[model samples]
Target: MHSVDHRFVELLPTPLERGVLYISGAHDIVAHLCLCGCGNEVVTPLGPAGWVLRYDGRVSLSPSIGNGALPCKSHYVIQGSRVHWLSKMTEDQHHRAQARDRDAVRGLNPTRLGRAKRLFTSLLRRGRV
Candidate 1:
């Protein structure tokens, strides 16, 4: 893994110019928290993915932070993010992630599904794709 200088996220690249982005990952990944930042805490927008040793930035959806860039705590796609959804993905990994998240959500919180649903819906309420 590329050793990144932990700091506030800026437009930069990592030493290896690669990282992971997960919807609900077990490893540290990048995410754009669907909800805009609030002084209190950051909600899930960033997700996790299997670590990759390459960088590819997709502005509309995912933004790859180069090693030089510092990411906010909110941007770290670790746990506590409702990363059950994602933009692009590897076919095999996608299937596995979906199942894992699905199982993890089961009996987690009777209202968890509702909360996650709202989070996604709020992000999509723009009325335009």
Candidate 2:
């Protein structure tokens, strides 16, 4: 229910400042993360509700299969991936799910915003003031 109406999803995301998301102690892999530590910064309270929030979706769940991904909705880390893909999740059952995950993430991440963050990181890495 990550994309549920904001009014209903509002309080659920705030109180849990700390949590642990096991990548499917069940059958599916789960993407997870902690609170952003800035509640006011979180648009979750006023984030798009209903179909409107289709872009900044709070989680990654393929509507078709019903596998609710954890809270890490940002860009995925391309761990051990090839130039063509980010990871080895090209399995048939996981195909749509991964696409949904990446799509939801891309929507959340606008090019401008990502470039800004990347610039900040690059500066930080260079120890530039």
Candidate 3:
């Protein structure tokens, strides 16, 4: 298992260091290098529809980060500053995951009217109502 040093920052550093997770509450984002040593910058935005960050001495992020678009296609979860690697997803799995994410984001509308509209639209698309 890999480990990462967590830092709370107002803004990300010029060049992100490897093995470090830079979290910016001010910007609602987290940035770090790929844990697979791929030297790619992976950023996770914080929000209702995105990853959630928690801290109690050690940092944790809800929902795994899947870099399917990246060459390495790394997938992992961060909990208590420890990296737990996951198996690579197939192309079909990736497409389904993307669709689930889109639906999740669409359901996060703040207003009741907005949510109702989205629910109706989704039902229409599914031919369920």
Best by lDDT: 3
Candidate 3 stretches greater than 4 Å from native: 110-129
Candidate structures ordered by TM-score, highest first: 3, 1, 2
Better of 1 and 2 by TM-score: 1
Cα lDDT for residue 86, candidate 3:
93
lDDT of 3 by residue, 7-124 (tens): 8999778688999999888766788988999988887767766689999999999888887877788889999999999987567767877897677777775673364456447535
User: Which digits, one per residue and each the tens of the lDDT, describe model 2 over residues 1-129?
Assistant: 121211222112323232222222121132223232222111111111101112232332222222123233222221211111122323453556567545554665476346545544653564431
TM-score (all chains, Cα) for each model:
0.33, 0.21, 0.78
lDDT of 1 by residue, 1-129 (tens): 212212224321222122222222321223332221222211123332222222333212333221111122123222221222222334554456457556655745656556655645743563211
Candidate 1: RMSD to truth: 13.9
Question: What value of lDDT does candidate 3 attain over all alpha carbons?
Answer: 0.79
**Model 2, total clashes:** 0
* lDDT of the structure predicted as candidate 1: 0.31
Which of the two candidates, 2 or 3, achieves a greater lDDT against the reference? 3
Local distance difference test, each candidate: 0.31, 0.29, 0.79
Best by TM-score: 3
User: Which residue pairs in candidate 3 collide?
Assistant: none
